[model samples]
Target: MIIDGHSYCFPPLGEANGFPTVQEHLRYLQREMADHHQPVWRLRDWAVGDNSLLAEPQDKTLQGLKEVNFRSGGYGRFVWTVEGEEYAKQYLPPYLTDLSHPPEMLIAQMDYIGIDRAVLHAHPIFGFLNDYLADCVQRYPNRLFALASIPEWKIEHDSQGIVNEIQRAYSKGLNGLQFSVHNRYRYSVTESWDAPACRPFWDGVTALGKPIFFTICAPCPGSTVEDYLSQLRIWQGWLTRYPNVSAVLTHGFPWRLFLSDHGLHLPDALFEPFRTSSAKLQLLFQISLGNVWDYPYTQLHPTIVQLVETLGSDRLMWGTDMPNVERFCNYRQNLETFRTHCQGVISDQDINNIIGGTAAQLFNLGDSQ
Candidate 1:
């Protein structure tokens, strides 16, 4: 069974909600303001991946503002829309943030891609609304696992402690939590992974007995590589500070891709501590794949071969960051890169670990490990 560590579904516009079309979202926003009787779910409140994205593009003028977009600075590059109209049209494909992609749509895609299951989360920078994610997973219990998102906004705003929010999400049957050290967009708010203010939040997750995963990407625009490395160190401190916590480090594919072309090593300062602590703590690495074939030619990036050699296949895992990757090719073709590239470098057992076995062991899927 292939388990994709990173995959998402921002259901196609819900016809009931008039989604994909802005009328439904506007209606909800209007009603939310008029009646505050009970808690109202505004589209942007928890609809992380697509709310603002869907609305603004519809505005004839704001479409021109894509030029002013700011992603997190450090190592995050600045993107100027040199090619205007052409870029806007290709910026985000309609299906990715579509209004109709429901659980069934995902199941069909899974079957076509030969993926048996996936670890799920909301879109980057948007807060984690596991309720919607949980519903999707529940409908396809055999195929999806929902990871609760840390409400970065709430934690920053509400002094009541995020423990309650974390507890509530876990009580609802969400499996784990996902946060990133590297903030995706300039407007995205993220608390430090090792902040003292987060003790209560961390303790709450500790109680749930589930692991936390950190998804990382290199070349953060404003920050230096050291800033990115500092984030890794912060996570390492967590592994040392919290003995029971298991963490997954992801999107190492960018680093891998960069290294293969540049001939630089994945700085030992960052990789060594995690490697040494594996026996004493739960720290694993995950390799992410998206539509990189457009630039780096995407066939397993040789970095995985080096990583498997150093960390061992059991310590490394694989993920296909889907929906976003569909722009490259269909899902099955994505996995084909892995199958063909590993030819004789590592044993089949090693390949199994990267594909699904390691996650089964880490997430504790019975008998599958």
Candidate 2:
């Protein structure tokens, strides 16, 4: 029942720069789980790649650049593969094992590892919604859930289209929608997401009465802590305005803001805003990066613990922005580290909520299961 909220799958090897093929990636995952002596059922990966249809700025080169920016940093490299030559060694064995590959090899890996449920997000720009999810759910009824990625940009001005997409996905038995507030098209106009243009979409989602997995990427325009703090305030304001929105702040807001630099410490101001916000919003702050547990940054654990104390476990969830940033973190280890440090600060019930229940409840997966 340990639900991993954020995870990813790469494009087929021939399609992308990261792993060579989906099968290779899955095998590596299986081997990694075995090495750690972990059960697969405890894990759930949210496959992110293969978003060809949602590609905006129609120009292929621009799209490629966007993909590289989002997925090709130092963190991205490590997630798809290990630090150095070890990644090649780790993947080569699996690559040679089998030539036949399923389109959902990523999903297969989850199954092989004993993962009871998996939630998937179809890339928004690319129209290729995950058709595989239905089959996976049919095949492993209790273990698979799909979260449709609505093309907010295309439908941003078209409220009806947005509602149509939501209804379409729901009709397919999909659980929820992965709404991106940071992509160029969605939240570009104004910092306030509760504006009139977006009200209809929000109303539709709220009417669905299902939990929507909302993500707001911190605007990392500069290298200073001030830049990170500024973005944190924007998000805090967002949560404050939409108290009914159940949102999860992924990519460790301030951490990713300063990730390019070597500094691991977060500014005190980031958590300061949330102290006064309402708790009904169900905000789930994640420690996605693995290295957060090491040195100087260990101080962040206490602050995060305090956030949980104030926000409650029902509002917290564990996530690893996999395939997007590799670094020292991934799925299994990140959760283990989070659990290790959060023991006394958070209760077992809260831990369970953070691990899976919260996400499940937020995303409305309970009834689907």
Candidate 3:
């Protein structure tokens, strides 16, 4: 079975609250936070309509920005606002005004890509998107699996709230918990899940025996590499203490770090300890188009080869990051490009693990029928 180990799906168009589009979400944040970063994300970029990549050749704004994984302007972490015309840009080739993909659309796309099943990360919305995801899973249980998202405030401020949300979603049959809390300035280290206020929530996650997934990446400005690295340590601390749980490093190619301002792609030495930690660390490689990371020298494929050799094949998985990168290349291209990269460096058996076999086992999707 060809299983896409990592991907995402948005709730259908009209199902959105205020924060559905990137621009609206940023506008909401700007209104809420009386902070320095607000202007950087709000006034100058989103409001002014000055987007470098959006103006580029792709014709699809969100998809192109996402295709490059929003490498600049704090857009990678969804910190920057992408408004009106920008929202028209799609990761898919067609110029789309509505980014919504109901279950049928997602299923059709999956069918086209030859994906038997996929583990989906729900879109982070104004309210809990779990119910929408639950409905999708219920409607197509064999074809889709999902992880639920929690608001950053709830995860940081309300411990019981976090637990409640998780329990509710789990009871509804969501597969795991997902967070992309990349903004350290707003959700400082003290307010994170590892902190006392949220410890109960982290404890509950371990207790529930569900896998955890999060995306942590360095914000472009007003934050340093140390700030980002510190959070990674905090995340690892949780993995170390709760040795029984499983978690994935889901964003920014943190598997390797963009160390130094010169754009050097080197592996973070701090993550070296967790490579063999008891808590399983599976990496979902979600680049757009090819077996490449825009980084210097080693694209993600070579890095995956290193990771597979070091961490063992079971510890890594392939994912297209779907819909988001669809504008850059066809789904078949994403799968095949990695296959091309693995041709020389990775053994065919290990390649199987990185692509689908390992993820199916980790996500417990059972045998592909």
Candidate 4:
């Protein structure tokens, strides 16, 4: 069975999407960017090719901004206009603009791509979707496993409320929790997940016996390799504290940042967390580094081989940050990048383990299958 381990399904990015209004959402975006010390207001366009959604030549005006409007197009491109001059734009699958990504649409894409199952993820931009995710899994019990997301900003002020949501989500059939450390830095005062303020939240999730998908990253833009390593050290501490809790390092390590003039310079200390049996790492290359490389991703093959060698294939799992990746490559390429492209370097047995076996065992997906 094939599983696309990391994917997002969310409402449209407007009033009905999550925030009270489009302006409110934009304000939230601006605040988030400013907090991270990034340029405010202008959203960076990461989409490329014939379908690039960034602002064009005619959109140079930036003086009087009385009205700001975010309009979604039928062709999967959305534009943010400041009084008539388009300032920012982004791309989503046309289906997503129509009504966001429902489970049925994702399932149809999976069926077309020969994917047997998928693991659903949540994010702050998607709003409170624990209940929504639970309902999706309930509708397609055997096909999807969803992880719950709580507002990290609320963790400090409302610990019990956060714990209640975890218990509530698990009771409703959600599989685990997707906790992003970068987002915590962007939204809250505390930087570390193992901080005293975060202790209650950690204790609550640990009590549920659910896996924690830790989305670790640099504290801010232009961070160094040491900054990335420091975050991993905190994660290592968490693993030591909760030895029985299963932890998956979502997006794996930040690969592009670690590369230098010589080659990939991953310090041995980065692998220290995996010393515990409870840790697993998700392999998400094509989508994560799509802007830097093209389809088939030959540049990343060596990196993939090294991960399998260092961590052992049994501890690695394959993931496609799909829907979002549709702008980069199709779902099929994401899977084949692992299944077919890695044929010479990775043995078939190891490939099987990375593609599905590891996730199946970690999530106990075999019982449902």
Candidate 5:
């Protein structure tokens, strides 16, 4: 089973009438699978969250704006229009009244794409989390698991409460934690990740000994490509301090550091630091949003292939970073593109590692080694 380590199916929130019903979302996914001519069972979808679809109109609007600001800050410009709205509406539901609310599009997609399991995250705590996980697992048996997202602000005030929530989720068979580097609630890139306040949480996670999936955002204020390189250097040093911690970098380390559309043209020297340090960390690099496929770059396929060759497939995984924002292509398309490009450089066994084996091992899924 190929497990997509990171992916999403954000429920729509707000006055935007264009949201697809839960069933609609599934249906659309089925259509996508059929279009690609891939068997559904070959894929395992991890549905991480921005469950704003269940939020009130005002909250959704606020989150939408935040999303816009984040993207604009990173990409420089963005245009949202009726066409985009209409497109979104075609797939999203207006509201998610309950955790079991089945958006038609998603149902369709799941039917077509063959989502064996799903993991949910995002706001409004207990109600949705409990309901959604129960519903999905009931439907799929042991296939579905929930990944808890705790309130960042409350980590200091109620560390025990947060730990309790994680323990509770795990007791319910939820696999691990799902967090983004830019999580609105917690230590965003704007804050130094190594701050003393966050150390205890890291310690807690290490104690759990479960896999931690984190997104990496680029171009943070007061930080440049060089700064990112420095951060990685620091991270490499930090990893050695805690031997039990294992991480998977959702987007390649230097993704945000690329300055040109032609990825290869970007100074190759910048990558040397990552290449040198990455080899030493118990980290896996994933090709997701902000990765080679999303950006317009010349000879991107070759560049990606070369990177895989250098990094080794055992240290790489595939992620789609779905629904929250569509990258240049869909999940299946990206995988196919990668496979086509790396055919000569990577063997079938290596491809298996990238597609699912590596993730299965990283998360200790299925039978233990």
Candidate 6:
């Protein structure tokens, strides 16, 4: 069966934002800006309101940037506003204004794209969505599976709370965990999960016996290949220690970070983590480098061949970032990039595993039917 290995579902703007509070959310976003060099800003000159890619580009007032607010432009857009003037904005799907990207919305997109099932991810920007996602999965048991989110920042301080939430979310039928390595910055000193303090969190995850979907990338823009390689080493160490824990590298490897005028320069050392039996990688190029490359992404075909040859076809799974990727290409196009475009570079047999066979086996979707 065809399955989207990655996607997101959340509530409406009012219900979604204001996790701990608007001020804290702003601080977290600021930390993200400082920690990572977001390349999407380069997509369009945010100055002078040039969000032409959006269906309805709104006015951008950058002069008086005072506070960030949600529910702007009728509740679908996240805007940087001060006294009612929007300075900058992040546009979500317009349909989200009704009540966020519910299961129905994603299922409709999946059906239109001819996807049989999908796995959902919980994003911090959308606040904690374990309960919401549990309901979504409950509503569409055969069609969806979701991961639980934890406040990584609190793990060092509130380890019990973090573990409790994991157990609770798991008992409620949430499938696995979505752990963002970058979110650890919310805590003053950033450390890898292998750190002593994070032991309990990992132990809890181990007890549940579910896979972890990881968002691992360079911590900042100025980070070198070694810096990225260091993160992979940490992952390799974790997999070595917890041999039973299945791990998935969300969005695949950071190909964009390694790409330059010299073209994609991925070092052989980078694929070491996937050498672990329990590790898998998600190929969602459409969301990560869609702005930098076009549909069919012929440029990535060679990389795909290399990954298959090096990591083995069974270690790779296909995923679409879903609704968020709409700005770059529609849902159908996202699937076709791997399914149809990379035909010769990737054998039809390997393509079958990359698209659906692997995901179904990894996520245990076979029994869901």
Q: Per-residue lDDT of 1-369 in model 4, one digit per residue for the tens?
A: 788889876665544344456665544443332222111134345422221122232221111122344445444444555444454334454556553777888899999989888899877655667878889999998889999988775686688898898889999999999998776655434556678888887888798898889888877546788888888888888889899998899988887787666446677888988975559999987655676678888777677778888889988988987787776789999999889988988899889988888989888866358
The better candidate by TM-score, 4 or 5, is 4
- For all predicted structures, in order, the TM-scores are 0.70, 0.60, 0.73, 0.85, 0.61, 0.86
Better of 1 and 4 by TM-score: 4
lDDT of 3 by residue, 231-288 (tens): 7777777777877777776643543335343333546554554565743344444342
- Kindly report which residue stretches of model 4 are placed more than 4 angstroms away from their true locations once superposed: 16-26, 29-75, 261-263
Q: Which stretches of candidate 1 lie over 4 Å from their true place?
A: 12-100, 124-127, 153-161, 183-193, 217-222, 256-264, 279-301
TM-score, ranked from best to worst: 6, 4, 3, 1, 5, 2
* Cα error of candidate 3 at position 358, Å: 1.7
Q: What's the C-alpha lDDT at position 102 in model 6? A: 77
lDDT of each: 0.52, 0.47, 0.57, 0.73, 0.44, 0.72
**Model 3 lDDT on a 0 to 1 scale:** 0.57
Give the poorly placed runs of model 6, Cα more than 4 Å off: 16-18, 26-71, 74-76, 82-85
Residue-level lDDT tens digits of model 2 in 1-369: 756566544333223212245433333232222222111120024322322221332322222222111211121121222222112112211231222223265456555443445555444322235444444445655655666666455454887777876787677777766766544323244434555667777777767755566555533222366655555576676667666655555544545454433434455576665566533222223333333445223445565665566667776766644333233443344555556666766677876777678667765566445
Worst 10 contiguous positions by lDDT, candidate 3 = 31-40
Candidate 5 stretches with Cα past 4 Å from truth are 15-138, 141-146, 184-191, 218-223, 254-256, 259-261, 265-298, 324-327, 366-369
- Identify the candidate with maximal TM-score: 6
What residue pairs are clashing in model 3?
61-89, 63-91, 91-327
**Candidate 1: residue 36 Cα off by (Å):** 36
How many residue pairs collide in each prediction? Answer: 21, 20, 3, 0, 38, 0
Q: Compute the lDDT of residue 143 as modeled in candidate 5.
A: 45
lDDT ranking, high to low: 4, 6, 3, 1, 2, 5
Question: Cα RMSD (Å) between model 3 and the true structure?
Answer: 7.9
Candidate 3 segments whose C-alpha is farther than 4 A from its true place:
12-15, 18-95, 125-127, 183-190, 219-224, 252-264, 268-270, 276-299
The TM-score obtained by model 5 is 0.61
Pitting candidate 2 against candidate 4, the one with the higher TM-score is: 4
| Residue 66 lDDT, candidate 1, scale 0-100 | 31
